[model samples]
Target: MAFKFGSFDSICGQGALPVCPLLGTSQGIEPGCYSRNVDLGGTIIFQPGACFIHIIALIMTLIMVLHIRSKYTAVGRKEIALFFYVYAVIELLCLFLDSGIIPTAHVVYPWFTAVHVGFICSIFWILLANGFVGFQFAEDGTPMSLWSLRISAFVVWGVSFFVAIATFNGYASFSYTKPMGLFIVLLVFPIVCVAIYVVSQLILVIRTLDDRWVIGDILFGVGFFTVGAVVLFAFSVTVCDAVEHYIDGLFFFVLCMLLSVMMVYKYWDSITKEDLEFAVGDKGAVWEVKECVVPSSFPPSRLASLPPRLRVFEVVALYLLTRSVSLPPSLSVPCSHLRTPTSRRRTTSLRTEEPEDLSSEEWEETSTTAPNLLEETTEATLPRDRVKATEARAASKGSTTRTHRREVFGTKKERESLLGRIGFSFFDASLPLSFFL
Candidate 1:
C-alpha cells in the first residue's frame, strides 16, 4: 500500500495494509504487501544491518535474562530486570513485523495492539523501577512516597490507555485520515516522561551526594540515552519516514541492558562477584546499606529492614528453603550470628573475615539480634579482670554496630541514592561488564 508522502492517497494499491513500521508503512498490497527493505517479485527483503542489530540485541537480552535468573536473588531487582528482558522481546517482535517477517494484516491488529501495550508496560516498569531507586536514594524507609509511587504509575498507564485507543483508532482509520499527529503525541509522551525521570534523578544525585554513588548514576545516565534514541526514532518516523529503521529498538535494548546490568551488580554484587570482582571490598556495614534479602541466608540485620511489601517474604522464603526448593548455588550468607559458640569454623577461599573477630560464643553473647518482644534478656557477667582487659574493645565494637544499625534505620547515607553509586569509578564497573560476555 503506497501512501502518498505526507498524505493518505493510497495510490498504487491499498489492499491489506499489512504492516505498521515504526517509521513508515509497509509497501505493496495483499499477498505481496511486502517491502521491509524491498518488495521485489512480490517477496519482502530486509536490510542486514537492521535485521542483525535486532538479532544481536535479542541475544543480549536473553543472556541478561539467564544471568539474572541464575545469579541475582533480590526479587525487586529480578522483576525489574525481567521487565527489561520482556521489553527487548517485544521490541524484537516489532522488529520482525517491520522486517516483514510477520504479515501486517487486519487480523494482526488485535495481537499487534496487545504487543504495543506490552511495550508500554516495559516503559511503565522501567519508570516504576527508577522511581523505587530514586525513593531509596532520598529516603530509605519512609512510607510517605507510597501514594506518589502508585498514583504516578496510575496516571502514566491511564494516559497510555487513552493514547492506545487513539493509536488503534488512528490505524483503523489510516486510509481516511493520517494518525501522524496522534502518533507523534503517543511517541513523545512516555519517552519524555521516562527520559526526564532518569536524567533528573542522576542530576539530583550528583548535586546532592558524594562521588562514590556516581557509578549507578552513570548507568542511569546511560539509560537516559535510550530516551535520545526514542527522540531519533520520533524524528525518523515523522520527518525521515524511515519505516524500516529499527535503530530505535536496537538503541533501547542496548542502553537498557547497561542500566539493568549495572543495577544488578551494585545491589547484589555477591552473585556477580567471583567472575567479576578481584576483591569485594567490605566497606563496613554502615557504608553498604542492605537493599534486599538473600533467600539462602538472610543477614540478621538486613532481615529486620525488609521493604514493606516483602514483610512476609522472609517467611515464605524460609518455607521454600526447608522444602528444598532448588536454588542456583551461591556462597552462603555470613550467618556468624547463627553459629553456636562451640562449632568449628572454616573460612571460604574468597571471603575475608572482618578484623577484631571474637569467638562464636563471645560474639553471640555480645551481639544484638532482632527482638521477639517476648524473650526475656539474660545477662552474663564477665570476670572483672577480663572485662577490664576487653572493655575498650567491646565498647568500640558496640558503638560501630549501633551506628550501622542506626544507618539501616533511616539514618546515615540518606542522601546517597542509587545514581551516586554508579559514579564510583569506570575501572570498578569495567570488571563486571568484562564478565558479562
Candidate 2:
C-alpha cells in the first residue's frame, strides 16, 4: 500500500527528482520496503505552491500594512505581522532562484548559495514573529518602546546577514552531506526559541489579564504558536520529509493569512483601558463595552498600552468566553440577514435606483408596512403631543393673555422643528430695531 494524497498520485504517476520519496509504495520491501515510480513533478510543480501562496499572503499583508499606516497611527504588532509576509516573499524568491520556478528563473551558482541564505532569513522571521508576541505581552501598563522593537528587528537582520555569509562560505556545494549542525541551527534553535517566547508571552498575559487588549494579544500569540508548532513538526521529523515541502508551505501560508485577518480585526480600533469594563458574576464574566474609545493621538510607541490589574478568573474566562458580540435575548433581525428592510426595501418616500422586486400590491404593502413600523418606533420614542398652541387658540382673542403667554412660554422642550422664539444672542448694533434689522 502507498501513502496516497487523494487521487492525485494515481493520476499523476512518477515525477523526476532526488527529493521524492525513497520507496513510493509498501510492496517494494521484502518485509517493509515499498517502491513505486510516482510522478512527483505532476504532484509538485517546479515552482511549488509556496510561491503562489506567497502571492496571496503578500496581497493580504500589503492591504493590512497599508490600512494600518494610512488609517491609523503607528505599527506595533501589526507591523510585526508584516515581517511574516516579507519572509514569505523572500522564501519564495529563494526557491525560485534554486528551482528556476519563476519565468526566466536562471539558476546561477550564487543563487544556489542564496537558497541557504533565504532559509536563514525565513528562520529569523519566524523567530521575530514569536518574539513580537512576547513584546506585545510585556506591554501591560508600560509604554512599549518603538526604539526597542526597531533595535530588535535590526539585530535580527544583522544576525541573518552573518548567518547567510557563513552558510555561503561553509556550504559551497548545494548537495552538502546530511548536516547535524544545519539541523541544530535550522530546526532545533528556532523551535526552542519560539516555544520559549510564546510560552513566556502566555504567562505574561495571564499575569495581567485585566485588559481586554491583553486577551486579544493572547489570541495573536496562540496563532503564531500554532504556526511555529507546525513548522517545527515539519522540520524536526526525519520521516516527514520536510512536510512534503510544497503542500506544507501552502497550508502554512493560508493559516498565516487567517491569523493575520483575525489580528487585524482584534486590534482595529486601538482600544484603551477606558474603552472597556468588566462585569463578573455567577453567570460568568462579559466585557462591558462603553463608548469604545480609540486613542485620538497614539503614543510615540506604535505599541498598544496594556491595561493593569485584573482577576486571574478574567484571564481564564477570556479563554472560555467567546469573541462574538453578545446578542439580545430576542434579536430584532437574525444574523443571517444583516441589512435592515429600510436599507434593502425601497419606500415610496425615497426613489431607489433599483426597481422593487415586488408586484404593485406587494410594493404598496411594503411601502405601507415600512411607514407603520417607523410610526410604531417613533410613537414609542416620542413624547405625547400636548396641544398648547391649540389650547391658546381657543382660550382668548379679545384679551392679549394668549399673546402674552405665547411671548412668555416661547418654546416646547421636545419639539422636533427649530421654530422656537430664539432671542437675538449677539447684536452687532444695540438698537431697538436691531433684531428686526
Candidate 3:
C-alpha cells in the first residue's frame, strides 16, 4: 500500500496503512499468475521457496560459525563466530515468520518481527565492529573487545526493537501510515553499517597486506550483496511474474546472502594467519622434546627428576625407534641405558658362539658380567681392553657372521641419535606420534 511521505493526514491512496515487509501483509503488489499456497489439513504455508532458502542460510551460518571456532589461533575468531551466531538466529526467525508457520494473525507475530528486525540491525553493527577488529583497534577477542561489542549490539537491538514495536502499535510519534523511525532503523541504519564495514575492511586489507587477492573476496562479497538487494527490492514483483511464481527474488536473495557470508569467512581466514607451529589446545599440541635422550651421558638425578609416565614414554619411544622391546634381566635401569653398542655386539657374539667353546671359568665370568651389563653399558666410556677383547671374540666368529652383524647394525650414520631415529619412526608408525608426545 502507498504510504504518505512524512505526512500524517489522510490523503487519497497515499494515506493507506503501510505494511511491514516481514509481517505477510499485502503491500498493494499484485500476485504472480502462478502464485499459490500449500494447504495441508487446515494449515496453509506461504512462500515455501523463501522459507527453504532461509533454512539453508541458517545451516550455512552455523557451519561458518563452527569453522570460525576451529581457528583457535586466528585473530578475531570469537568476534566473527558471534556475528554468524546472530545471523543464524535472524535466519531462524525469518524462516518461521516469512513462511506463515507463525501466521500474521498470531498474537506473537509483532514481537517476533521486532526481535527479527532488531537482530538484523545488531548483526550489521557487529559486522562493522569486526571490520575494526581487523585493525587490532582494541584486541579482537579480549574481554574488553568482546564485552564492548556485546553491550553495544545489545543497545542497538533494544533501540531498534523499540522503534519497530512503536511503529507496529502506533505509539509515541510512530504511525502505520508514516513509520519514519522504523524506516530509518530497519533500512537506513543497516545500509550505513554495511557501507562503513565495507570501507573499513577494504582499508584493512589494502593497508596491512601485501597480498592483493583478498581484495577480490571483498569485491565478490559486495557484488553478491548488491545484486541480492537489487533483486529483492527493485525487481521482486517483475521476477515473480516472469518465473510464474514458482520462485521469487527472496530465494535468490537468501542464496546470494549466504554466498556473501561465506566470502566474509574466506576473506577473514585468508588475512588472519594462525601460527600452527605454536598452536595449542583444540587445534593441536605444541609440546616438543627438545633434548635428546643420550643414555651414556644421562645423569641419574635427571632421570629421577622426570615423571613416571614420562619415563615410560621414553621407554616406549626407544622401543619404537629400535623396533625391539627386549628387557634386560635387571629392570632397575632405564630402557635407554640398555641400548649400548657393546651390549649389542656381546649379544651378537653370544648368538654365534658354541656353548662348548666356553670353559667353566669363562662361563662363570660371563655369568657375573651379564648381571652388571646395565651399569657397565651405561658408562660414559668403555675400557680399551674390554673393547679389544670384544673385537677379538667377534673376529673369532666367521666373516659371514660379522657381515650379518654389520648389516643388522647398519652404518654409523644409520645408527643416529635416539631422538633422530624416533622422529623418522613416529611418522612411519600406524598410530600418530601426537598421542605419545
lDDT of each: 0.40, 0.36, 0.62
Predicted model with the maximum lDDT: 3
Query: Which stretches of candidate 2 lie above 4 Å from their native place?
Result: 1-48, 74-85, 91-99, 102-152, 168-175, 178-181, 209-437
Off by over 4 Å in 1: 1-45, 67-76, 121-125, 137-162, 169-181, 207-209, 212-437
Backbone clash pairs for candidate 2 read: 13-38, 13-39, 14-38, 14-39, 15-38, 15-39, 15-40, 25-34, 28-34, 29-33
Q: For candidate 1, what is the lDDT?
A: 0.40
- Give the TM-scores of the predictions, in the order they appear: 0.42, 0.39, 0.64
Ranking by lDDT: 3, 1, 2
lDDT of 2 by residue, 290-327 (tens): 22111112111111111111112112222222233343
Residue 212 CA error for candidate 1 (Å)?
6.1
TM-score of 3: 0.64
Winner by lDDT between candidate 3 and candidate 1:
3
Residue-level lDDT tens digits of model 3 in 22-49: 2222232123221346777888777777
Better of 1 and 2 by lDDT: 1
